[model samples]
Structure formats: C-alpha cells, structure tokens
Target: MPKQKGPIPITGTVKNTTYFSLNGQYYERRKSSLTAAVVATDPAFAASRRCNTVFATAVAIARTIYPQLPTHKRIAGAFGQLTGRVYQMVLKGMDADSIVTAILGE
Candidate 1:
C-alpha cells in the first residue's frame, strides 16, 4: 500500500488558544494573544488600516490643528513634515534618553 500525501503537520498550538505546561514554562506561548491586544488596537494601526474611526478622528484633529489644511493632501503633507522633524531630532542625538524619547515620544 502506498502512503497518501497530505499537508505537513505543524508543531505549535493554535493562536488565541491558551497553552500551559504542567510545569510553569509553557505559559509564555500565549504571549501573542496578550500582545495582539496592543498591536491590533493601536491608533496607528487603525489609521494605517484606513478604519473610519481613525480617519474621522485624525481628520477632526488635523482640522482643529490646521484649519488652512482642510484637504487630504495638505493633511498628508503636514504628517510628512512632522515625521521629517522627528527624524531630524532623533538623528541629531545619539544618547539613550534622546533615542528612547524619539522612538517612544515624550
């Protein structure tokens, strides 16, 4: 008899499923589920995904901050300018506090 081929078996437990060892070690396996809470719900992630919640909120914030830049292209340009300022600020300093504050922001 010939063996039938099928999809390869994977070793890890399924996502969102809790996996714990009889010993205390395997509990870390569920870290993604916990971390996904932050990654999945972050405002930047929502904005990048083009979610209405983020877009509308961003537009409102931008309008309040810069009433002259009512258009989307102008708002995008503002974002680019802000990003470039942030990049220059970080690039000018090499200290740990500066780098951390740059990446994490004040």
Candidate 2:
C-alpha cells in the first residue's frame, strides 16, 4: 500500500473592512429589496427577467434529465442558443410569454 499524505495548508489574505455603508442615503451603494413577485410584475424588468426565468427553468429541466453531464457548460450553451433564437423571434414581434412557451414546450 502507498503512504498516506497529509492535507495541505491553505494560505490567503483576510481583509477586515466594511466596504458598504448601512445608511439608506447612499443611493448608488443601496441594493434593491424588491421581492420576486414585485420584480416579476415590474414593467421595467419584466421582459428581460421573464426571458431569464424561462431560460433558467429550461436548463434546470434539461440538467435533471441528464444529471451525469457537466451542466454548467451545457446550460450556458443552451441559454446562448435559445436566447439567440428568441431574440430573432422577438424582432418579428412575437410576445415574450409565447416565445418562452414555445422554447420550453409549456
């Protein structure tokens, strides 16, 4: 039998600094506290967000079906290809929901 090896030590820098202000007055640094429902219904983010949600759901379903595959790269490639086709369909004036349904088959 081969000799056992010990675990290697990990070395990294530890920074102790507060990069963000907790004060509500700093608009630029402030992050949105919007909930998922609010974001889903918001007109400004609706189209882009809907597309992202649909694409993500599709990829998740695909990953579930093929769990042995490296899903990150596969999902990324699927998203790119699906988005390209969806973009073309959108240019021809197709509704976002219909496009998502067609691509996802639901």
Candidate 3:
C-alpha cells in the first residue's frame, strides 16, 4: 500500500496492483478477484453472504415504512445511512430475528 508521490502519476491496473487517484492523491491497492456469484456461493464468503442478507432485509423494511411516513425532506445519504446502521448492527452480532421484530413491531 505505497502512496504514489512521483510527478508522473500512473493510474489503472499494473500486474497484481491497481492505482487510482482520490482527492488529488494517488494510491495503489491489490486488485480484487471476487465476484458476486463467488461471494454468494463460496464458503469463504459466508460472512459477506450474511451481511448481504441483512442489508436486503433492511432495505425491505425501509421500503415498507417509507411510504407510510409523512412527506418530509431527507438528507442525500439518508437511505444509505439507515441501511448501513442495520448492516453494522448485523456485523456486531445482532440476531436477524430480533432485528425483524424490532423493525416490524408495533
């Protein structure tokens, strides 16, 4: 993970590494070979599968509740913020059943 400091900035993949510029700075990272199918079906990606499942459930919950709310302005990232918090809770070992109960409970 070396920062690119040279005057001549190189961006894009070179062998096993990838270079990209962000906020006027350049950095390199290892290229990932993972794909959606691999993540879904691979035992090595069980945690990712769990997280994805939780995120999808969170999205569904939001969808059901969103239409019932009063028409109020929302922040640009509000949707992501809501779902991300749920995903974080999942990562922190919150039970899926408890999450569903909390969200859909009266």
| Every model's TM-score | 0.20, 0.30, 0.55
The residue pairs in collision within model 1 are none
- Tens digits of per-residue lDDT for model 2, 11-50: 2322531123233221112234666888778898878887
Model 1 error, position 67 (Å): 15
lDDT of 3 by residue, 1-106 (tens): 6798778999999998899999888999999997788977899989877767778877776665445434563457766765675567666777656655564463
**Predictions ranked by TM-score, top down?**
3, 2, 1
> Which portions of model 2 miss their true places by more than 4 Å?
1-76
Q: Evaluate model 2: give its TM-score.
A: 0.30
Q: Name the lDDT value of residue 60 in candidate 3.
A: 70
Model 2 lowest lDDT segment of ten: 21-30
Residue 90 lDDT in model 2? Answer: 62
Best by lDDT: 3
Best by TM-score: 3
Which RMSD values do the candidates have, in order? 15.6, 14.1, 5.1
lDDT score, residue 61, model 1? 39
What C-alpha lDDT does candidate 2 achieve relative to the native structure?
0.52
